[model samples]
Target: MTHDPTDQYLPRGEFSFLSLSIGAMIRVLYYRLRGMRPVRVGHCKQCGACCRNLHLFHRGKWIQTRRQFKRMIAECPEYERFEIMDDPGMLLLFSCRFLSEDNICQDYENRPSACLEYPTLDLHLRSKVLYPNCGYSFKMVKDFGKTMKAVAHIQEQAEDKEDADE
Candidate 1:
């Protein structure tokens, strides 16, 4: 899914960077505090907040919902209705259809790749740019930060390998 810069809620330019940093910090804190807890933090309460709050991006692309999937014959269709919507730098909105009235996925096990990978702290941190009104935003932010650090470490290793090869 692609977001328009003209979107009312979309984040602009340098603000995205600041938002990513803040999200990462929040994610780190959440993990530190949520350790050993049976219940995961920043998770849906089965309230379907994500589904109810769904908004499509500028293009016809949107997140695939269970209902949408049911219309498709195969799990991976030739024309996927949804695309990973990013605003040049960060991911943005991808609404789901399978979301129940209670905000739970009716067919979670068979959900698409996008649904399976939701609330990824890194993606959330990168995309949300500014915190949405969701309760999980803070926790997602923290996770995103930790993930960013890990990604940076990985990138550094890749760069080191290239330098050595040179």
Candidate 2:
């Protein structure tokens, strides 16, 4: 499903990043443990929607003003590649300078990590949405609800058996 542009902005801080990364790792581990692997689906449509509509964050908050974006650039010079596209009060949207008129990356090979990792499951988990019309999605190998329930039932039975033995 498409995420509303007005939804809460994702935080950008060391702690927030770490927590999200850890959570994503845990989620992957859980799936692996359950024998359910996640698979990436769909190919890029080259629509440039991702390049044109970006919700950037810095210092645990969404960059809401040009001043804040400027500060971010000062701190991370590489961020200068992004330009402010709009500020709808709540958040500032950005566009990459490398995105060309033909909806192509001018520097495809040298794109930023954010660009390379667009539509990642970690991002989806954090934002609960993806760019509208983007041709990418993720899905698990299989549903694990029944498996987890069965596991819990087996554990409960084992615990009961031990208690009876005691």
Candidate 3:
């Protein structure tokens, strides 16, 4: 079988809020059928993975690397003046520009809604893709609040094994 990667990421059918990406649709169906919801691990660990792995939504994908971001800015001239949300240190740290020396958000109280909803599944998203050291988990329930699956997800098993190997 042949594969066209572009066709994978591009959304088919009419583009609208109701329509979601294929990956997101799968996750949404899973959670809706199983009644899964965000279950944050008690207390913030301030690991800063969310910040370091900073993701920006653009062109039906997440802009992660700086080079990609620069290209995005080039393509969208209006974005050349994009708002700066992080602090200056982020340039050197390559984590979150908003993170303090101790890994706390410098503007925690005034952080954007996206920041406030760290790890929360968005409209088109449902997977519980947490950072490597994030203190968050997903609780899947059925039978009216009876917990079925409550797993505190850490790094991927492959990563754990890789670390063990080294």
Q: Name the best candidate (by TM-score).
A: 2
Cα shift from native, residue 32, model 3 (Å): 3.3
Predicted candidate 1 versus true structure: per-residue lDDT over 82-107, tens digit per residue = 33333332233444555556555655
lDDT of 3 by residue, 49-108 (tens): 666555455565655556666787687653343344553433311244566566666665
Roughly what TM-score does model 2 have, to 2 decimal places? 0.59
Error in Å for residue 150 of model 3: 23
* Regions more than 4 Å wrong, model 1: 1-41, 53-75, 78-94, 128-166
Write down the worst ten-residue block by lDDT for model 2: 7-16
**CA lDDT of each prediction against the hidden true structure:** 0.42, 0.67, 0.48
Is candidate 2 or 3 superior in lDDT?
2
Per-residue error (Å), model 1, residue 145: 16
Clashing pairs in 2: none
lDDT of 2 by residue, 32-144 (tens): 67777555566677788888888676665658899998999899777788988887897788988877787867776556546655665666655666677777666677646
